[model samples]
Target chain A: MSTDSAAGLLHDLAEYRARARRDRHGYWLPLLVFGVLILAAPLVYLPPSEWPPPRVQVSADGLFPGQIKVFGLTIEPLYMFGPGNGREIGNPMGVSWYWFGVVVLGLAGTVGWYRWRARRVGVETPTRLVVLAGSVGLLFLLGVVPLILGQALVLLFPGSYFYSNTAFWISVEVFVLAAAGTTVALWVRGGGPRPAWRVALASVGVVVALMSITIVFEAAFGHGHAPLLLLSVALLAVAAIERSAFCAVIAALFTAAALLANLYNMENVFYRFGFHVDYLNPRGEVFANLLLPAAVLIVGGGIAAWSARKASRRE
Target chain B: MSDHPTAGLDDVVHQKHRLAILTIAAEAKRVEFGYLQQNLDLTKGNLSRHITVLAEAGLLDVEKGYDGKRPKTWVRVTSAGRRALAEEIATLRALVARHENLS
Candidate 1:
């Protein structure tokens, strides 16, 4: 071909590369939404006049007592279960409510300000395989290992395990081991080209990110948050890989999972635990509590996927 | 046609801006004109001129719509345009190889 045609092709290729380098709306929006959703409940929750929504309570005698023993750890039962009356337990994260909102809001605002000020560009694709494996490993360590060890400890020292310092120490050690394992796994796969120091730094960053997420989620909702949290992370990652219509489908699946989680949590706390508080508008409260958030997640994911498709059509 | 890289290059797709437009359009189901213009860093007049030429050659399907109140234009590469672009690139690569051999 002529010089002009060759030059044109090169120009187009260069343009494509440049566009690829710039951050697309598709990935960033969903990521931002994910961050917001994760932080929103903890940071922006306002106490209703009638707290805990509408629920029916059943009196259980001595079901919970002061410093109830569980797997060798003496933990406070937020609920009072005595002779004639048993009150609903306040959530473990209740103390966090006093300070969590201000702290999270401040942190989120500061980060938002910094990001906006910096006006950074470009999309950085994490090592998906390494990150995925490390994430799964992290979950196993944080979750499965703890339960297994706790069970073993209970079996080994039936009487002594309760309210023991050993339990706390064991928990700490397991946490560290899990974090280290995940970081090392990530580094082994993705750190070869980087300097040793950089690898160490990246490993720390990965560990910190994973740990912070675990802590925030654990702190925010404590038990039963894991399944939905894992689902969200997995779906978002998949959306990044697939993009567009497929992402929309993933978003829908994520919504379904989230719905199940909400139902399960509500059922566990409300009916099983018999901790029910009246709502000003019970039906509206139920709809707002369960359906609204699920709808937003589903729609938000769809929009993000659509934008991603439009922005980067290539698979 | 001669057995030269330049022999069968399509004129509509040979221009710099138009080629970039085609490549971008080919990637998306239908690429917004604004995306093409912003990505290629071309002024409205310049992009319009190139887009008009490609449209005339039946290489681009241009659609006019409204994004809320604002008018929007979207462009997609026709099948013919996709074939032409592929042929053009292949020819251009061959031309480069032949020239390098000569050098």
Candidate 2:
């Protein structure tokens, strides 16, 4: 090629790079939707019974213990045992809904973080179709199926062993195992340069990890079961906004950390509730809980690092 | 001579605008028409004509679709297109190198 053509090519190349660099648009819409979601979820989730109880009347003398007023609304504190123990227990439903809202907000936060990272890396922002399909599929697989199967198993056994506890364990095992399996699969297959079944599996793995963590954490906190709807929205939002497998990996890491904490705490909580499983022993539980999630994170991170190195080498 | 650096340059692929389109498409994997036009500072008619030329030459693939309500177009470099771009870039680099040597 002539020197002029060579110079022109270099100039065009520079222009292309400059344009891509200037294509930086913030993810404001996703952020707005996330805010609306966080606010709206509690409204939809709170049952009428959970609405703040009819305003309690404080004695005009103000000598009553635990009597407080805020915004002219009299408040009575609930005490397990005290002179002013007239406080009614707040509806558990309300508490559950509140945490559920937090969980959804947490998911939104994760997506926002990933979306910003995606702009830097040039990961394609996921399309609406991808988001819808991924969220719906995860809900069907991890939520609906588990509940139905758990109920059916309870009915079939009619034993205390097979009741709520059995169903809960079964669901956890399925979700965690699926997440680990998918992560390992993706790690082995390597999601690079093209979309493959491994890509789909990686998505499944991330969704299942999120679900498993939500369930385990809710159970640990004695919070109300977070509705699957919140999880579906979280998955949809994250899937829609994030295009990198790294986001999925980050999500998996978050879930794994939660799982480790929950597992350690589960022994004490479940033991107190008169539930004893073999792995409750300090050493055994350590082996049981730490093995899968920890291994998944370690192995997945290693594989991803290696794959990136390999790709860079190829380039 | 057949060994001349310009011998490797493909006429249909080496045009500056098409080279820009190919480079963007190669980097993005799939690039929208509006993106190319905006980036290259070309009018719609001009971009459309250049894209048609590249597509007819089998240097890239043009896909027509809708982005929500608005009509949209995307261009992607095919395997042939990628090879052509790579070869063109290599030749340009060689030409630059030869000129640098002479200077």
Candidate 3:
């Protein structure tokens, strides 16, 4: 080959290498941040003795006392009790650290995977970042803020909190049902224009029926039964007919619900091994409680947006 | 002898770097000027000139603003631009199909 051709080939090879380096850099930075966070979780759980113990106050008549003797294991409360004798408990050390690790790692892994795929296909970072930001923003607006506000209100009002109100409970159930239904419907539609009213209504019906079956199954088996298992199955069925986002959104909704149930002590199980783990310190709890869902939302949203953009380009 | 018109359809749509800008805009719906510059690996002046050409042709709309102290420029495709792109793609497809048939 001529010198000109050889020079062109070398330049092209250099360009390819540079692109690869940039992509790798993008992939590793998020992973490193996530890994560091996970590694640091244990420190939060087993803080130095000099680090002031999280202040926890329990009301004399708090529904669940600071101490619970369950099957002979003495479990201390997980949140901090305030001046009003309201029970304050922090996360259990093992559970909290485990969840913090899971969430941070999960988020970083998801974001990294997404960016890697986009880079492989030559999608730009700004577009990916916008989608990521949008997803996180939506999650904060829908899930994290509500959770924080709910917890704060519960702490402030103690006995008089709306968390225990029938209306509020009904609303929560309705919202969950709606979210699950919409997710299924969107999945069925498969990134097309929104479905017609009848289709949407039918999806809602299906969701309600599934929810009813779950409740009945729970009643038959035991109250502490895992709702996520059923939801996951439903999501799988939806995935078979529709898009993966439907499944992802459904899974996220179920995860959020499980988190909420744990937050309120509605679930008899304190924390499961995989996603429900929490970091035990008050500051850690605050961080995990606020950050985990936010991360999931952002990461999930970014993937969805990026996918949508990719599909559009192909068309 | 070729009887068909619009033989330059590919030339129109696949012009160097212009297609890149259009592809980016079409996927993103709206994109920042700095982002376009970084992703397309173009100098600010080169990108600005290309953007000006597209804007002149009514293929794109450009907006400029400031974020705190930093100036920002955003670009989006116009309806006419989308139609033109669609026509260009169709013409190219037709040409390919004709060539395949002849072969």
Candidate 4:
């Protein structure tokens, strides 16, 4: 080859290398972290005896009766089951399977959607592995923190878990609100269509109104309010349809509200549907703590995967 | 052939450094000045000049605050900046497609 051609080849090689570095560095690292966490979920459930038991004490005078202590805070136990006579009754493995299934399904759906969209667009979209990683990290900070705190509260001060410690719920709500708001702001400012402030304000107003209405209906119908649960489920479904960070926020808010309402009334719609809230009890706190957050993470993860696949197909 | 389809593709933002800065800023909700400098591998002076150009173009908003007593500078892409960056990318892609097809 002539000297000019040789130099030209070298230049092209350099450009390729530069592109590789840029794309690889930004995209792959976070994805690897996410993958590791997903793979580690099953391993998290060791034998129950290896797990610490819920610390519960009945008062001598029956004055502070049936209180459970967790994380240095004292709260009444939500249920009065007989203390463990060494027969491990609860199914941590089943609970893990349910959560894992939700996450996997959600991720698959998201990945599938993205791949389809990318193919249709006929442009290579950026790798969303990094974005997925960031989302997972955000989930840990926002979703996981509140959940752990909520579980701790339930274990420690069972009586006050539902009502008196409004701060915990409020903190969770704030995190969810901020995450949703930041995402909307970023999306809008990132060149997506700008939604009107009035629309947002109206949506908030409507959510509050609906929640209040549900509460009233629940009061009238007692704990078995199918309509209220249906409403909650519908809202969650709508949030998923919206397919933005705001949707995740809305889903989280609705889930939190539903959980609180259930706890307050000592009723579990999730349980009626064969989902367990017994895990929320002191003995099963870790499973309770991990389950819902993991569900939300998986949902978000699925969306990220879908978005990535869409981007790749476009490319 | 032009090295880049985006090469000399003039808009309000065809400048290379400015494009890089905007891209970085757009990805982050907020990014520190030093982080931008390190990522772009630009000198402090070079980064500052490009940042100024972007700020003037209304594509970025630069804020200087104190993290304790030390001064901290952060950059964020404005809505206008995001639009410009998106337009730039689309234009670049189109140019590349056109050139590739012709070749």
Evaluating just chain A, the predictions reach TM-scores of 0.32, 0.34, 0.29, 0.25
Which candidate comes out best when scored by DockQ? 2
Over A1-315, each residue of candidate 1 has an lDDT whose tens digit, in order, gives 355556556766766845643333334344345434543443222234435523434335332323334566433332111110111323323423322332234334433532342222212223253246436744453444334333434554467453355644554565576667666655565635656675576676555444434333333333323334444545555455434455546556665656554444443345455655344333232333434335555466566656656765663
Name the candidate, 1 or 2, with the larger lDDT value: 2
**CA RMSD for every model?**
16.6, 15.8, 13.7, 15.5
Question: What is the per-candidate TM-score for chain B?
Answer: 0.91, 0.92, 0.80, 0.86
Worst 10 residues of 1 chain B by lDDT: B24-33
Give the C-alpha miss distance for residue A54 in model 4, angstroms.
22
Query: What are the per-residue Cα lDDT tens digits for candidate 4 across A1-315?
Result: 223433343344344334322222211212222333433443444345556534444476442433445565443321111121122433433333433343444344444543443233211223354236434533532233233433544554457333433544554464456556555544545355656874575466444433333223323322211222332343344334333454457456545644543344332445566666544343333333334433543455465556556754774
User: What is each candidate's DockQ, to 2 decimals?
Assistant: 0.12, 0.22, 0.16, 0.06
- Give one digit per residue, the lDDT tens place, for model 1 in B1-103: 5577777677678776787787766654466666666777899999999999998999998888775687878677799989988887777777777776787
Docking class of 3: incorrect
- Across B43-92, the per-residue lDDT of candidate 3 in tens digits comes to 99999988888888888998787656877687887887777666654554
lDDT of each candidate versus the true structure: 0.51, 0.53, 0.46, 0.46
Q: How well is candidate 1 docked (DockQ)?
A: 0.12
User: Estimated TM-score per prediction?
Assistant: 0.37, 0.44, 0.39, 0.36
All candidates in order of TM-score, best leading: 2, 3, 1, 4
Query: What's the iRMSD of model 1?
Result: 6.1
How should the candidates be ordered by lDDT, best one leading? 2, 1, 4, 3
